[model samples]
Target: MANEIAGLVVIVTGASAGIGRATAVSLAKLGANVVVTGRRAERLTALVDDLADFPGRRLVVPGDIQDEQLAQELVNRAVAEFGRLDVLVNNAGLGHHSALAEMPLADVRTILDTNVIGLLAVTQTAVAHMKAQGSGQIINVSSIVGQRPFPHNGIYSASKTAVNFITRTLRMELRPYNITVSLVYPGLTATEFGQAKLGQSGGNRFGLQGIPAQRVGDAIVKAVRYGRTEVYVTLFDWLFTHINRLFPQSIDWILTRRS
Candidate 1:
């Protein structure tokens, strides 16, 4: 408990790679006992190998967070490993992309299952314990698409958009209990997640995007250090998100041209 985040026990899903993995490492460096969950046991082991000297405690729980039973089990595993839970990073998500016309209902359902439903289940489960403790933080990972509707990725966009709305609402609901809810919208970053998860990607359709995954990881670190309601990792992205809000028509036209 000597590091910045020393005393907190944080759970990060989708921890096999990308933002989730980066977050686990970052939090660990800060002395937070971190529990990483993902489906791939090998990748989780590799992650532990990479962060061999983390300042804080590290545990890996390989499982699908999309299941309700698994979500509760995730919290149980964290408490069992770390003694208590102080933060829950809901980063386990899947992306689905395709033109609405070409999109299969099954693919869209999968996106909702992983992104929205799973997130809700985990958050709900965390709330019970956080409410009892009277303090905690829940960081929900969303995307730029949560704010801007992307072409050929209607389903993915909607799923993250739901995260945006839900996180905000939970923030208000949990405020009295001293529970902090935050939404992190990472525009674009160097993560194999996009290509590996979503069949059709926005990178090709929407040209060059945001910065590295560490930038988002840095933002997560900031959120953990000083609780925030919402955070946009990149300055330009933060600017554009605001701009899109005020000038929806122009942004829509720009997106149409780009797509």
Candidate 2:
């Protein structure tokens, strides 16, 4: 029998904190050799040290995934150090807020580049390794915004929408080689990811209570092991998004300050 994700070689980007950190730690606990990558070397080092007894090896490759070349190098390093790449968790991302009119082109580009293109760059290389292996799993960390546009979150929603689309495409495209793609769209989670600022403070204390990051990490572990197309970490989040589609502008009347 195959390893069933246990003792698998997994690569996780943006593993410094939030969902990425939790996911890396969880995968490690599941007997996976997880390669954690991010721009913050210190944070990565701390996580690496913490998971010292995580059943499998852990390595930290610090860098910005926005750089396509560096993205390739990340895969090379993981393959070189771990000897195989069974799963790639494209979790490195940032979320920002600003009215579309006031949104800086630079800011817009940053969101698109990091969330969209940056993810694609790493995923491209991951697929290459998986294809060679003849079987693998790619779990793209998306958002509830991907399925439905929410107030004060246009560009972020669009980028996630792109991720959602690409994930479905990858599933169909890679199926020939037995590669599976799982899109994990999480709702309110108590991570820096839910913050108003990128990896900063502020979260969804009002709309819907957030969940612990460990819950999502555990879910990813299950998805990787069982093979799922797309999953929402919370039922409420999934319901909220489905409602938003039928009533897009309905929430505008809520006039929530934080939006």
By summed lDDT, which 10 consecutive residues of candidate 2 come out lowest? 196-205
Which lDDT values do the candidates have, in the order given?
0.84, 0.83
For model 2, how does the per-residue alpha-carbon lDDT over 1-259 read when each residue is reduced to its tens digit? Answer: 2346677999998899888999998888878899999989999999999989768898888998778787888999999997789899998888876566667788788888899999999989988888998988899999987887654567888999999999999899999999989999988777866553542243343666679988888778778877876888888877877877787767544535446
Task: State residue 214's C-alpha deviation in candidate 2, in Å.
Answer: 0.9
CA shift at 76, candidate 1, in angstroms? 0.6
Off by more than 4 A, model 1: 1-3, 201-203
In candidate 1, what are the lDDT values of residues 84-156, reduced to their tens digit?
7899999887877678887778887788989999889888888888888888999999988899887777888
Residue 80 lDDT (model 1): 74
Q: List the residue pairs that clash in candidate 1.
A: none
Best by lDDT: 1
Task: Flag regions of model 2 displaced more than 4 Å.
Answer: 1-3, 194-208, 246-259
In model 1, what is the error at residue 176, expressed in angstroms? 1.4
